[model samples]
Target: MKKLTLILICIASLGLASCKKDTIVQSANNLTIIKYIEANQWQSSADGFTLSASLSDNRIDDRTFEDDGILVYISRNDGNFYEQLPFVYDVQSYSYTVSKGRIDIDIQSSDFQSAIPDKPTTRTRVKIVLIESSQ
Candidate 1:
């Protein structure tokens, strides 16, 4: 019985000593930028008003182009709050589209083709968020 106990203890010690741990850590980053669009900066498109801004760099690569995320937000009250697009407020609808190098924001009346009664007469602040994903 004593020899059997010693043998079991040695086996347990060997098992614990031989155990190995392999860990991999991955990290992801996100980039945020702010752009101010003056009332006059909103251009007229066939559908409605449009605002365009160039990205700081063509930061998005092929990896991001396929799986990354892009978010566009607008502040109606001096940054106190932000509303994400495409959102409908009052009677105007806001939306956006992203490309490799630029972003375009569009606003149209709820009626879709009608002119917005409150076309932006004041400057507007816009927030842009780019998600860089890693695995």
Candidate 2:
């Protein structure tokens, strides 16, 4: 009886040890802007315009593009929602990156020229949304 009780106690201990729950840490930040930038004229040429945003306490430099991701959204008005844009980090394209507390964005006018025609007299408004996440 003593040996059986000892074995049962050992088994219970092992079961309890194996039942330990895993602790997972997760955090996320979302940023939204209505008409972050407005331009008197919309151009359709490369390097015609540039836009940027600064995010504080985002720890962006520590995140890898693969493991972590940055999501971007843009719209011409404040009401309609647009699909998320694919983020690119390259030399020759509309690209963006985050480091420390600042997010640097380069927008190519030619990419959106069709959507936004080159109209000198018309006013253009742009809205942006940025999402950051970590685990």
Candidate 3:
């Protein structure tokens, strides 16, 4: 009986050791964005807006990584929407607009990579920014 128990314990320990540790795969698929600041002038004279976005690089293969793009759809307080592409060659882009009395900016990632090439299951991080312009 003791021998049987000892063998089972050893087997369990070996099984645990053989299991691979969880690691975050970094990838170019991760996007990053910069945040914008609101200016005081934007309050009265003109409405201004700025924003940026990108994907996170953790859990993705840099080799298979491709340039992630960003698309922004902005909606003003007055119920007007505008679309803009803010990524160029895997880099972040900035957008700005000024009007009479309202500013709105929204940003999101526009591209993705296939996870099957590297492994069965993969994870990634995405980011977005909302900016209210001041100038």
Candidate that scores best on TM-score: 1
Kindly report which residue stretches of model 3 are placed more than 4 angstroms away from their true locations once superposed: 28-40, 45-135
Q: Write the per-residue lDDT of candidate 2 for residues 1-135, one digit (tens) a residue.
A: 999999999999999988868798666666555434344323344544544333343444455333455554544333355534534322223444555545544444445433322322323233344456545
Q: Which of the two candidates, 1 or 2, achieves a greater TM-score against the reference?
A: 1
The model with the greater TM-score, 2 or 3, is 2
TM-score leaderboard ranking: 1, 2, 3
* Candidate 1 lDDT score at position 27: 68
Enumerate clash totals for all models, in the order shown. Answer: 0, 0, 13
Q: Each prediction's TM-score against the native?
A: 0.65, 0.35, 0.27
Positional deviation of 13 in candidate 3, in angstroms? 0.8
**lDDT values, one for every candidate:** 0.72, 0.46, 0.33
- What TM-score quantifies how close candidate 3 is to the native fold? 0.27
Q: Give one digit per residue, the lDDT tens place, for model 3 in 1-135.
A: 999999999999999999998888544433334323332212211221222222232322332223222333422222333334333223222243322222233222223332111110212122233332222
* Cα displacement (Å) at residue 10, model 1: 27
